[model samples]
Target: MAMGMASSGRRRGNRTRRAAMAEINVTPLVDVMLVLLIIFMVTVTLPAVGVPIELPESRANPVEELPDQVNISVDNAGRIYLENDPVAPGGFADALATIRRNDGEQPVIVLRGDTGLDYGRVMAVMGELNRAGFKSISLVTDGSDTAP
Candidate 1:
C-alpha cells in the first residue's frame, strides 16, 4: 500500500507539470501578432483630411533644396493669381496650358486661398487642377498671427 501511494503521488506530480505547461503557450503567438500589426501600421499612410486649409502653426523648417513651385492665389473676392500675375476666370485653362507647354513634367501647383474665402471656392480650384491633369498640388498658408 505504501508503494502504491508513492506511485500515485509521482503520477499526480507529472500531471501537474503538464497542466502548467499547457497554458495556451500564448506568449510567442502574441509576440508574432504584435509584430505583424506594427508592420501594417507603419506601411499604411493616412490620407490628409478636411479642406486642406487652416493649417496649424509650426516652426519654420525651410528645405535647402526644393523643386520649383507654381503659386496660385485666390483672393477674398475670388480672383485668381498665377505667380503674382492676375489671371482672369476664363484664362485659368490657358495659363495652365502655358505651364504645361513650358514644362512637360507637371509643375507643383500651390493653391493659396484667402482664409475668408468660402470652402467651396477652394474645392473648386482643386477640381480645376484635377481636370487640368495636375498630379502634384498643395495648399499654401501664412504662419503669421493676426491677434497682435
Candidate 2:
C-alpha cells in the first residue's frame, strides 16, 4: 500500500500544474509609457511646424509674446496659415472654430499678414477670427519700423 501511494504521488508530481499569467508585469508597460512620454515632451518643445513668412516691421511694441498668442499669418502669395498650417479661404471659419476650441475662452490671436498682401484679405481673415469668438487680435511686425 505504501508503494502504491508513493507511485500515485510520483504520477501527480509528473503532471505539473500550470497557471495563467494573472499577474501583470507592469515593469515593461511602464518602461514603454515613460519612453513615449519623454519623446512627446522633447518634440513639443521644438518649433517643428514653423511657417515661413516675412513679418512686416513696425515701431510699436508687442503686447503678445510667443507660445501664448496664436498666429494667423498670411504669406506674400496671399495664402493663409493658422498656427503654421495652411488653411483654405473658404475653410477659414472652420479652422478658426477649431482654433477657438483648442485655445479655450477669450484667446488672443496675433495676425502676421505679409506687407505685400492686400489689406482687405487680412481684414477678411480677422473678421473670420472675430466670428469664431476671438475678441483680441494683434499684428506682428519687426520693431525697426517703430520710432527709435
Candidate 3:
C-alpha cells in the first residue's frame, strides 16, 4: 500500500502547475537614490564674490544662501555690478534676459547695496529687477550687536 501511495504522489506532483513570480524588487532603486544623494551633497559649492561693499549693520537675522540665487551688487556711486561684472544701463535688459533664460524659472536675487549708496538708486535697481522677471529680492547686510 505504501509503494502504491508513493507512485500516486509522484504523478500528482509532476502534473501540478505553479504561478510565475511578478513582484518588482526595489533594492536597486534605493541604492541609486542613495548614490545620487551623496553626489549632490559632496558637490555643494560655497558662494564667494570678491566685490567689496560696506554693508549696513542690522539686528535682523541673515538670509540663508541657496545654490541658485543670483548676486547683484550696487556701489556707492550707484553703479550696478551683476555677478562681479559691471552691467551697463543700456544692456541691463539683455543681461537679465540671459540669466532668466538659463534659469528657466521664477528667479531670486540677492542685492548687496553699499551702505553709502542712495536709497533712490537701490529702489530703482529693485524696480528693474522686478521688471526683468526676478520678483524675489533679498538685501544682504551684516548682522551686528551694539558693543562698546
Candidate 4:
C-alpha cells in the first residue's frame, strides 16, 4: 500500500497546476491614457484657423508692441476687419471715428494687409485712419530671415 501511494503521488506531481489571475494589470492602460493626454495637450496650444492671408516679408526692424494699439486687417478678398470684427467698406471711417472718440486718446493703428490685396486698398484704409486723427500708424509684415 505504501508503494502504491508513492506511485500516485508521483503521477500527481507529473501534472502541473496554475492559479488563475484575479486582478487586472492596468499599467499598460494607464500608459496609453497618459500618451493620449500628452497628444491632446500638445495640439491644444497650436494656433487655431482664422482669416487666411499671406504676409510679405521685410527686413525692417520690428515695432514695439503696445497695449494701446489696435489692429486693422484686410483679407485677400478685400474684406476689412477691425480687431477680427468685420466692418462695412462705407462704414470704416465712421467706425474708426467712434472708436477714436470713445478712447479719448489716439491709439496706435497696426495695419495688416494681405499680399494679394491691391496697394490702393491698404492706402485707402490708412487714409481713413489718418482722417480719423490717428497719427501713429504701423504696417505689419513678416520678418525676413536674411540679415540686413
Candidate 5:
C-alpha cells in the first residue's frame, strides 16, 4: 500500500516535468529571423531605376541625388519609361507637363539607357527632355572605382 502511494507521487512529479518542458524553442525562431534579414538585404540592393537595363560604364563622377528626381529609362527595345510607367512616344511631352504641374517645382531628370541601345535613341529622348525645358538632366551609368 505505501509503494502504491509513492508511485502516485512519482507520477505527479513526472507530470510537472512534462509541463516544464513546454518552453518555447528559441532556435527555430532565431533561424526564421535570420532568413528574413537576409531576404531584406538582398531586396534592398536592387536598383531603383524602375526598368532593368544594362547601363554603360563610365568613369565620370556621379551627380548628387535629388529628392524630387524623376527616373527615365530607355530599354533595348527603345521603349521609354517615365518613373517605371510606360509613356507613349507622342504623349511624352504631355506627361512631362503634367509632372511639372503636379509637383509645382522642376524635378531633376535622371536618364538611364541600355548599353546595347543605339546612341541616337538616347539622344532623341534627351532632345525631347530639352524641349520640355528641363534644365536639370543627369545621365546614369555604372561606375567603377578605377577609371579606364
Candidate 6:
C-alpha cells in the first residue's frame, strides 16, 4: 500500500505546470512621470515676456555725454525732424546727401522715435539711412521707459 501511494505522488509530480509570462512592468512608467513633473516645476518660474514701455520718471538716469550726434526725431504724425528742424518726406534723400557731404568722419545718426509712432516708420527711416551710406546709426531710447 505504501509503494502504491508513492507511485501516485510521482505521477502527480510528472504533470507540467503553465510557464510564467513575461510582461512590461509599470513601475518604471510611474518613476518617469515623477521625474518629468519635477523638471517642469523647477523651470516654470522664469519670465517669458519682456517688460512694456512707459513714460520716463523724474528719477530717471541722466543722459550720458557722447561726441556730436545728428539727432533725428520721428513724431507720432510720421513727420521727420532733423536737429529740431522739420524735414519734408520728399526732401529726405537730398537732406541725407547734404549731411553725408558735410560729415568728415561718418557722423553718428541718432534716431529718437516716439513710443506712439509706428514701427514701420522707424524701419523706413533706418532703410533711408542705410541707402544714404550712413552705417553708424544708433537708436535713441529714453531708457526710463520700457516698450509695451
Best by TM-score: 5
Per-model root-mean-square deviation over C-alphas: 13.9, 10.4, 11.2, 8.5, 5.7, 18.1
Which ranges of candidate 3 are over 4 A from the true structure? 1-47, 101-103
Clashing pairs in 4: none
Query: Which lDDT value does model 2 have at 94?
Result: 77
Mind giving the per-residue lDDT tens digits that candidate 2 earns over 14-128? Answer: 4834455678889999999999999999867453237777767777865636455687778999888888789986888878777634435576688887778888988888888
Clashes of 6: 5
Model 1 lDDT tens row, 14-82: 363222344577899999999999999998854222233343343444222134767777887887777
lDDT of 2 at 15: 86
Q: What are the TM-scores, per candidate, against the unseen true structure?
A: 0.51, 0.59, 0.62, 0.62, 0.68, 0.52
Q: Candidate 5 — which residues are off by over 4 angstroms?
A: 1-43, 101-104
Question: Model 6, range 15-100, lDDT digits (tens) per residue?
Answer: 74454557879899999999999999997754221223232233345454345667777776777878767788788877778774
TM-score of 4: 0.62
Off by over 4 Å in 6: 1-63, 100-103, 145-148
Candidate 4 yields a Cα-based lDDT of: 0.79
Q: In candidate 3, where is summed lDDT lowest over 10 consecutive residues?
A: 5-14
Q: Model 5: C-alpha RMSD to truth?
A: 5.7
Ranking by lDDT: 5, 3, 4, 2, 6, 1
Residue 6 lDDT in model 1? 42
Displacement of residue 31 (Cα, Å) in model 1 is 66
Q: Which tens-of-lDDT digit does each residue in 1-148 have in candidate 5?
A: 3555433233553372223355788999999999999999987756776689999998898787766789999999999999989999788888877775335667789999999999899898999999988878899989877767
Local accuracy by lDDT, each model: 0.67, 0.74, 0.79, 0.79, 0.83, 0.69
TM-score of 6: 0.52
Report the alpha-carbon TM-score of model 3 versus the true structure.
Answer: 0.62
